[model samples]
Target: MASPDTRTQLLDAAERLFAERGYRGTSVRAITDLAGANLAAVAYHFGSKAELLAAVARRVIEPINAAQCAGLDRLLARTPDPPVAELVAAFVGPMYDEMRAGDEGGARTSRLIVTILSDPAEEVRSWTGPAEDAVRDRYLEAFTRALPDLPPQELWFRIRGILAVTAVDRVEVHNRLAGLPPVAGEAAKQWAITFLAAAMSAPPTGT
Candidate 1:
């Protein structure tokens, strides 16, 4: 097999470290050391550590975003007004599928996404860009169609809330922290999907 180029090596290293230690915990030197490249390589290729992180986030997130959008599109094509549970499954299922079937690198990318979603560091939090906005808009549109009675602000709030909950559960469930039994494989995926669907379908508050 052909060897990975320097940029690819740097991205690989950044993804691993960002996923494992988070962006704040990882340093440019650590990434270079893991990639077997010199420190200047990151600057040369990505411009800065922040840019490298943005690139890593794009690589990890774009494919999954596409999958999610496509899934929702297919559902809408078949059923213009799909049920809430189906919409949730279409939108949220791809990440779980990736977690279940992707290789080790892919799994790390999934964790990296969850880390990015939950990371409190200002730099990490600010990394989201137009691509993510587009995905969010696409999903929001589909969900709006599914739940027209849901006030727009409430819908957006619930969506963000469930996403935060889901991110936490994905990490905590996978790590089996506090000696809690890990819910693995398909069961865990279903649990997450069901929880999200229920939250999305919940009656609007203050009705």
Candidate 2:
């Protein structure tokens, strides 16, 4: 049987490799080899390679989502509701914070999520539903209360899509905007919130 720490070791290695290489690119054998565990350790700990990938993705995604949800708590306490833009920032700022806080592995993993979100087989895609749903619930509640005029379904979908773009874009945006670095915690928080508020509140593109 694998020890407690062995599970962590396997997860750590899997997170890095899966992030550095897409799901199809990472192998259970490689993960066990990197983790210095026996081949059976992977199977023993996590039923299959797909489960290992899900575990790795969860490690990176859960904390960021947790932080965002915590930030939502603060946003909720404000009297008369803050603008939707502020809410958007709350959604994304935590992710950028983690990515910059020596969570390069997380930054890479976020990109992998973008890939998964863009296209994935049913099994892989099903893994994301609950995690994303939890985070989305926080925003759905917030927006539903604050922006009564905005269509609940459309607003949430748009908010989610934009948040994904913001999270994934930070790494690349840095590469393109040589002089302008990505926003920091509070700044990103405000910026994302503001962007969401405007986008959510804006009329349709054709209009």
Q: Pick the candidate with the highest TM-score.
A: 1
TM-score of 1: 0.85
Tell me how far the alpha carbon of residue 192 in candidate 2 is from the true structure, in angstroms, after superposition: 4.9
lDDT of 2 by residue, 43-158 (tens): 88898887887777776677788888888878878754766677777776776666554454345656666655554566566566476688787677777766776675666677
lDDT of 2: 0.70
Residue 98 in candidate 1, Cα distance off native in Å: 3.0
Clashes of 2: 6
- Residues 154-185 of candidate 1 have per-residue lDDT tens digits of 99998887667555654645576567655565
- Once superposed on the true structure, which residue ranges of model 1 sit more than 4 Å away at CA? 99-107, 120-122, 172-177
Model 2 worst lDDT run, 10 consecutive residues: 100-109
* Per-model TM-score on C-alpha atoms: 0.85, 0.76
Superposed model 2: Cα runs more than 4 Å off: 1-4, 129-131, 152-154, 170-197, 204-207
What are the Cα lDDT values of the candidates? 0.77, 0.70
